[model samples]
Target: MERDFKMTAITMAGLEEVLADELRKLGAQNVKEGIRNVSFKGDKGFMYKANIALRTAIRVLKPIKTSKVFDEEDLYEAIQRIKWERYLDVEGTFAIGAVVNSKNFTTNSHYISLKSKDAIADYFMHKYKKRPNVDLKYPDVKIHIHIHKEWLTISLDSSGDSLHKRGYRSATNIAPINEVLAAGLVMLSGYKGDENFIDPMCGSGTILIEAAMIANNIPANINRKHFAFENWKDYDEDLYFVIQDALLKKITSSHFKIMGFDKAPSAIKKAQQNIINANLEEFIGVHHVNFFNSKKEVFGKTTILFNPPYGERLNINVEEFYRKIGDTLKHNYENSTAWLITSDIQALKYVGLRTSKRVPLKNADLDCRFVKYELYEGSKKMKKQIDIGE
Candidate 1:
């Protein structure tokens, strides 16, 4: 059995707690939350499970070494000291990425990456006659450099591409929510496979797809093109397949419906294509209709989660659009819990509904809030809408 070691699961800024809970549930030991990450310890099989099953994790990194650095030489020497041969061969290709949050670094991420790359190549060249070539796009090894103040940590990225590229989305919108964020929202909204899921402003059906995947307990990265760990020298292909097979056995179908709506023909078409790509056609349906003009498709309780246009990307009047959203929820969607993630705080006031909960989150570079509103069954507005009876 491989020895257990600490690993960090990178996540969206506000989802640290949720991701930590996920790690705990996945059987990680000594789980701890950081700003936009969580740390835990597990063996190789568990690491494979994490990359495959962690819905909120953007990437999982196995820390190989940690050292204090006051300057660039310290960074280079610490990196060179790690036995890179243990993870990658001299002829193999590799890529480096940096996430530096330190004053001592005093350089752009690209510069850090280049320095790390050079250190690795030089280390290999001194030992072996030839050195590994840098393949930025697709590499046999992916290294992550994290610098915090004077501390430098080098890690091996277990998940190659961002896990958000779940190998299912062939189409996207102008500002589609990141899949990791989408999944985190669904998880945070308290949706299990038990309730009906709806996305009114479903741009390309990301929320809907993530909801269905969660509902079915589907492994988050089951459709990923590849995981970087698969290329490691110690990679156990059979062990990985065993983990994948185990995850497959856990999938269970949900009885409730999952649906999406978008007024744009382009969005509707792309959503359908993406939903098909996810193999969730039976559980999800996309329709072409303006959200404000539509009512809840389900009769009983429903959970609606979506990312409406934040107005930064489009020319629409954000305030009025938000008002319509509030009106639609009040009149149309009774007995429902509606949540939306948006960067527009001022526009949120225009919605007019009292937010039951507000979660501060960062979407890409934008500071956003995930707000929730409860629609009571048989409220005055619902009664009025039912009286008018559309």
Candidate 2:
């Protein structure tokens, strides 16, 4: 059995707890949540499972070294001191991604990455008289350099190309939500394939696809072609397949309806194509209908989630658009719950519905709110009476 080691899963803001829960459910040890990440201990097989199954994780990083550095020279020296020959070969290629937030260094992340790269190259040149090449697009070794205040952590990027690139989205709209974010939102809403799922303003069908996957208990990255760990010298191909097969066997079919809607014919077409790419055409349906004019089409309890335009990427009347959203939900939709994320705070007030829950989240670079509203079959008082009678 491989020895357990510490690993960190990075996620967006407001999703640390969600990611931590995911790690714990996967049988991680000493799970802990941080600001935008979760740390835990797991073996090599567990690491592979995490990369393949975590829906809310952006990337999984394995920290190899930690030190306190005061300047760029210290950073470079500290990186060079590590035995690079263990992780990369003299003839192979490598890449460095850095994030610096320190008062001691006035330089930016780009310069820090360059300095780290030079240090690694020089280390190889000194030992073997030749250095490895740097390939940004595809590299044998991908390193992550994080500097906060005086603390520095050097880690290996195990999940390559970010877990958000689930390899199923070949077609995308102008402002498609990140796959991780979409999955996170669906998980946060507490939908587990038992209830009908709908994305009223579904763009490219991301939320719809993620919802269907969750309902079916499908592994998040089952469709992904490769991971950075596959390039590692210690990678166990047989063990990876074993873990993958276990996850595949856990998948269960969901009968509840999962649907998406868009006013644009082009968006509906792209969404259908992407759904087919995911091999989920039988589970999800995309329709070309304006959300403002549509009503609840499925029976029983329904969960409606969407990433509406916030007047950030698309041109629209922000206040009136939000008002119409509230209006449609209040008058048309019944026996359902709705959740929408928007960066427009002032416009949210125009929705005119009392929110049951509000969460702060970040979409791309914009600060946003994920608000939930419950639409009853009749009045709240009448619904309460019905519940009391039951």
Candidate 3:
């Protein structure tokens, strides 16, 4: 019945291979990628590290059981078999989140979760005569059921909340990107410790913070307040401290520049506050300046990664803003690899530059394209007619 004898499953957001790779670097063994989650084998200490350090993982789950269920009846039986007393007491509250992707279970995820909840409640009612209450917001025990075809994998949500909540940002402007997605974008850009990084529209300084951590080889979750491992019944304090110390020892000094720019003074202030909150003020700088008016930095091999306003939620004129972005990148920034993520496919074409690479990425419900443009100082790479009509 020892916790170390059981296997753990770490769940992550989908299409975030770079984030999965980051998990592997942190000493997670048997790291495997699925649709929107990664399954890795680790002990309690590694679980703590995964919750604290994984940038792209939404939550880490310690899977309790996997079974073949043909119907809801079979699902109930599978749930009833597990010894839930180890994870939750009769006084504690619990919640079930079901993610179904099978032909037999064609209903919505909510309905599947309802059935699983009923099974757990019935089991506790029969055994203890008083079942645990269901607390959706803050549950003592959160269960995850991922049904793929006939296989149903039940896991305990080790991370109560998503790992993206690093507890740094106190404010957010319109259309702020998720911290995990921002970190993934930083990783995908391949900007290591060698180059200067800039986020012109760095709302809340998420990209700049993530970039600084990546450049300095710092643990992503060092600023976070809590991890699921802290709540575990068999938590090992000494082992967790050792892992933390080892990761801290690997931190290298970052010599590269990480700069942020925002036209709004309010955004700049918020970004600076968040940067300071993360204890990265010494490594990062924030300034209030319109990106269109700003030129490339003095460093020739600079990398600019940003999430510009898409005018989807904001009330900006899309055509003019897109034109200005293209104008700024083409005229001011040269000999740099500039990348921006935008969900508007139409607006991306208006950039007026040949895209070196067009990567498919998702921003919540919006399917976005992460496009890159290589700007050269001379006319050698500039075509007579730089077409982006396609």
Candidate 4:
């Protein structure tokens, strides 16, 4: 029988609760949310499932040890005491990544990573007269060291290359949003594929693909080629296959319409190719139509979610672009809820529409707000009255 152990799922700042809910659904015990991460308890099989199924998590980590240390010597000694031989072999390649938030350490995360690497290498050298080589790109055993004040926690990265690389995007436009963030945006909008979904400014079709997966109960990493747990010393190939098959069997067909629209012909082509790569071409349709010129074409309730340009990566008139978005949503997209994420706080005033909800989020280094606007089937006067009532 597999013994239960604690694990952590790292995510963006605002999606911690969403990740915790996902873990609980997957039968995780002692689920707790923290800053940019969620901690839970599960066995080995559950760890594999989390890697494959979690959409909002960037990576899943299995902590091996935690210790209190004051200086670099203490850090090195603590790392050396962990039985590295169990997780890694003398002939295997390994890498260490560090995150430091301590006033005691004057060095940065890169230097801390280097120091931890030396300690691991020395431990192997002293025991067997030879040490393993370091492979930063594809390590056999990827380790993580995180320091918060005087407490340091060491973990084994179970999901390598980050879970955001879903392996479906062979083509992307400039400043493409991360896959995890795309999924989180879809989930946050409360769209479960029961209603029509549209990405007005879909770039590379990321949101469209993620929405199709959610609607059809598809596993997040079904198309991913590899995971770090497969390289572990005690990896069970048969068990991994069994878990994967179980998740695959849970997939269901979705009939709701999922579509993407982009004014750029290049963006439309990239989105179409990526949709094909994800095997979701049958479920999603991409068109070269500017959203401002298009109206809600699908019937029944619909959800429109997009990551528009905030004048950060793409060149655009921030004020005018946002104002057009408000005009289009109010005049064209009737009986639909529109949600957009942007970093320009001042530009939001030009939108001219009262937001129903606003969520604080971070897009890479920039602080963003994911705001929602509800569009009812009415005239401009009625809409103004509705806004005034709110």
lDDT of each: 0.91, 0.94, 0.81, 0.93
Q: Candidate 2: lDDT over CA atoms?
A: 0.94
What is the C-alpha lDDT profile of model 1 across 1-390, one tens digit per residue?
A: 578999999998999999999999989999999989999999999999999999999999999999999888999999989988998988899999998988887889999999999999999989997899999899999999999998898999999999888999999999888999999999999999788889998988889999999999998888887899989988999999999999999999998988899999999999999888888899998899899899976867899998988756758877788899999998999889999988888899999999989999999999999999988877657657886985
Query: Worst 10-residue stretch by lDDT in candidate 3?
Result: 1-10
Better model by TM-score, 1 or 2?
2
- Stretches of candidate 4 above 4 Å error? 379-390
- The pairs that clash in candidate 3 are none
Q: Each candidate's TM vs. the true structure? A: 0.95, 0.98, 0.91, 0.96
Of 1 and 4, the candidate ahead on lDDT is: 4
Ranking by TM-score: 2, 4, 1, 3
Better of 2 and 3 by lDDT: 2
Q: Looking at model 4, how many pairs of residues clash? A: 0
Q: Kindly list the per-residue Cα lDDT of model 2 for residues 259-332, writing each as its tens digit.
A: 99999999999999989989999999999999999998788999999999875575888788889999999988
How do the candidates rank by lDDT, highest first? 2, 4, 1, 3
Residues 11-119 of candidate 4 have per-residue lDDT tens digits of 9989998899889998999999999999999999999999999999999999999999889999999999999999999999998999999998989999999999999
Which residue runs of candidate 2 sit more than 4 Å off their true CA positions? Answer: none
Ten consecutive residues with minimal summed lDDT in candidate 2? Answer: 310-319
